[model samples]
Target: MKKEPIIIGIESSCDDTGVSIIKNRNILSNIILHQEIHKKYGGVVPELASRLHDVNITKAVNKAIFSAKIRRHEIDAVAFTLGPGLIGPLLVGASFAKSFSIGLGVPLLTVNHVQAHILSHFIQDANLNKDYCPKFPFLGLIVSGGHTQIIKVNDFFKMKILGSTLDDSVGEAFDKIARMLGFYYPGGPMIEYFSQNGNNKKFTFSKPTVSGLDFSFSGFKSDVLQFIKNESRKDSFFIKKNLSDICASIQKIISEILLDKVKKAILKTGIFRIALSGGVSANHEIRRAFMALSKGNKKYEVFILKKKYTTDNGAMIAIVGSLKYKRNLFDSVHVSPYSKFKTF
Candidate 1:
């Protein structure tokens, strides 16, 4: 029997420095070093993020190797996220990957950040039930800090974007709204936590009138801003007093917007298999809505990644590396990292 190839994936697309070692589809070790320095700023600073990645990349790689219990020489390939992220961070990861692969005499692979998020479902781990993995030709909803899109996945490499956000992505809307409510950076989780104690219907926001499967969160965000401003003028303590209710209302609307587009994608494509990916996929409300949609109608089969994999991580990148390795797809040493979104 042929031995499975061991691959190392490096992800420094943004604030997190993630490194992972995988044997085929099975993850052996996944390490993510998050940069908390951006919290004070309420958003990621590109320069700071890149500098931190430079500082953390080597340590992250070493830790991953130690945790995986593998020698550096045993790695068959090195993969790194190459696009749709901060250029500085992307360069940091890409340069490290190239150097690492050269040192190990292994092939180098470049992964699209968005593609890794979607393919994360294929990572075989204890947390993921093998039977729940989506087959080919599934509809993929990728909602992250930088991107939001509905894609038609025909195969591992063949994906077509059916619709995407016209303005702000859902994740951005959540963070901005959270800021308005005086939450810390990465406000999605914080909002979800507070929403549990509040009523989702306490307040109503106007949903965007986007046509087709496309999404528009900018208008929704503006509505929330204006409402908060108006209410706060009347009573300075309005936001402080109704924080939970506000969070719940905003969470519900965002989740509904996402689900509405997903439902449209399903109906238009006639595909019942739905898969969710990216950072926002970890939101409790979004997951709950998707699960409810699936359970309410038996015709829909929903696949969601474990919470750990839902965020930006190297395991997702490693899984894509393993797939590309099998087809002898490798990157040239002179390959450059891109900041704009590009299809794989």
Candidate 2:
């Protein structure tokens, strides 16, 4: 029998530095180091994020190898995220991956950040049942701070974008609203936590109108901002008193907007298999909504990634790398990092 190739994936797309080692479809080790310094700034500072990635990348790689119980020389390929992220951070990971590939005499793999997120479902683990994995030709809804896209995944590397955001991403809207509500930098989780105690119907926000499967969250964000400003003027403590309700209302509308488009995509394409990916996929409301949708209808089969894989992580990158390696797809050392989104 042929031995499975071992791949090391490096992800420094944004505030997190993630490193992972995988053999075949199983993850041996996945290490993620988050930059907490951005909390005070209310958002990721690109320069600081890059500098920190430079400082943390080596340590993360070493730790991942150690945790995976593998020697550096045993790696068959080095994979790293190449784009759709902050340029500085992407460069940090890409440069290291190139150097690592050369040092180990192995092939280098460049993975698209968004593709990794969607492929994360393929990552195998002892606790995950193989039956839960989605088959080919599934709809992938990627919701991250930087991107909002609905992709049709026909194969491991074959994907086509069906729709995308015209303005701000859903994750960005969550973060901005969370900051306005006095939450920390990554406000999605906080909003979820608080919304649990409030009623989603207590307040209402206008949803954006967009044609086809496309999404537009900028108008929704503006509606929230204007409502807050108008209400706060009337009652100085309005936000303080209705924080939970406000969170619930916004969360509901955001989740509805996403699901609405997803339903449209399903109806248009006649595909019932749906998978959620990217950072915003971690939103509790979003996950729950997808779960409810699947339960309410037998035709829809929903696959929600584990929370750990939902955000930017090396495990997702490594899984994509493993798939690409099987097909002999490798990148040259001269490959450069890009900041714009690309479909695989």
Candidate 3:
């Protein structure tokens, strides 16, 4: 077998500062250093994220390279997140990657942060042959706090977003609902934990009305707010007592909404392979519902990224960059960070 090139990935698009070293499909080392400052703000503060990235990037890169047991000169290319993130943070990561690439005289591949999330599936379950991960022209669903969309992966570096959220992404919905229920700042997990004992049927919310394979979570979020307001009039502690059931129901509705879009994409495209990524994909109900649907079809294969890889991290960035760099895919150093979504 031919030896694969070593690709170093740097991710500072968000709160976590990540560094990963990938050699072909194999990950030698992935180091992530998180910032706890955002916990007080109930979410990521852009300015703080940028500052921390500047501080952590150096430590993360050194640690990752050291852990991988590879010399800096041995690295074949440098990979970094380019856009769809906080500008300052993205710049920090991008600048570092560009400088490193230039210094090493190796190629630098700038990766789309969201696309990297989907590609995360490629690195997480490396044990699985590429076949199980899905081939080109498959459907991909990316659901996170900041994004939600279904894209067609025509090829590794070629893609087209088929559908996206009109308002809030699924992850954002989860966070909003969690907060309204008196959950903490980052309450997605709390909602999930409390949802275990709740009855999904107790509360019925409207599913988003999206015609063209897209998604809309703002309406559902509105419904959640109305439901809480109406219930609170009856008893201030109603949610506290019925938190589990409410969470279960809310989670179920959101999962179904997302699955509906994926179903539409698959039916329209005639592609059976599907992948689920992003922070919200970590939800157990979403994973189970998606798995059940995929299992029913002989032509369908499903892949859900691991919890660690689902969140913003350099591993996904590194993996995507490695694949793209090997194919001679390099973005201009002038590529700037984009605050909104971008289609491939």
Candidate 4:
């Protein structure tokens, strides 16, 4: 039998430090260490995130290797998220990955953060529903704290941005709106949880009209703020009394806005295969809406990542790494990290 190649993936692109080990198409272990220091600040502190990555990268890698029961020498290649993130955090992971790969005498793979999120759909896991694996030439919807885009994915590395936010990503909008509603930091989950019990129709917010597939959440975010401010003046307890409903309404509007563009993209591309990725994909409301869009439609198929890979993680990076490895794509040791890099 041919030996399966082992790959190590490291991701410290932002607030979380992650390490994962994958052998062939199967993941052996994935370890993530989230930075809690930024919670008190209501968002990620770049410098603090970098410091935490420095502290945890080694530990995270060790834990992943230990959990996988694999020797460091067994890894054939090292992959790390290369760009489109905070420079500090990116440098931390990039520096560590380059040094480690050189020390191991293995080739290094650089992964684009956004591309990894979309490619994460291909990561094989025994626990995931096979129906969630999307085929090639699909429509990819990436929603996260830092990015929101509708992409046409033709192949492993061939992705074209059909539409992207002009300002304020979907996850950022969710967090900011949740903050206005008296929620704590990292409010996406809180908003999602509370939205379940609330009536989505109880409150209605204006949606922005953007031409084509491109999105503009800044205007919508402003509308949300203004609506809450005006309503709170009429009744000081308005937010408290309608917290659930407000959350539901917010989620409903956001989902609609996102899906509207997706609907347009589908119309434009004539591709029925749809895939959802990134942190915001964890929103149950959005996921349900996407699933509903595909249900009973013989021409439509929808795929979503497992909740674990929705956020910043090493597994996604490793999956991309494995794909690149097959193509003999490797990065030079002199490569550097960047806060912003195009996915294409």
Per-residue CA lDDT of candidate 3, range 143-250, in tens? 988899898988887889888888877878888888898887678888889888889889899987779988888898999999899999999899878878999999
**Whole-model lDDT values for every prediction:** 0.91, 0.91, 0.85, 0.90
Q: What is the TM-score of each candidate against the true structure?
A: 0.98, 0.97, 0.95, 0.98
Off by over 4 Å in 2: 125-130
| Clash totals for all candidate models | 0, 0, 3, 0
Candidate 1 stretches greater than 4 Å from native: 126-130
The TM-score of candidate 2 is 0.97
User: Poorest 10 consecutive residues of model 2 by lDDT?
Assistant: 124-133
Q: For candidate 2, give the lDDT of residue 216.
A: 94
**Candidate 3's error at 273, in angstroms?**
1.1
Top candidate (lDDT): 1
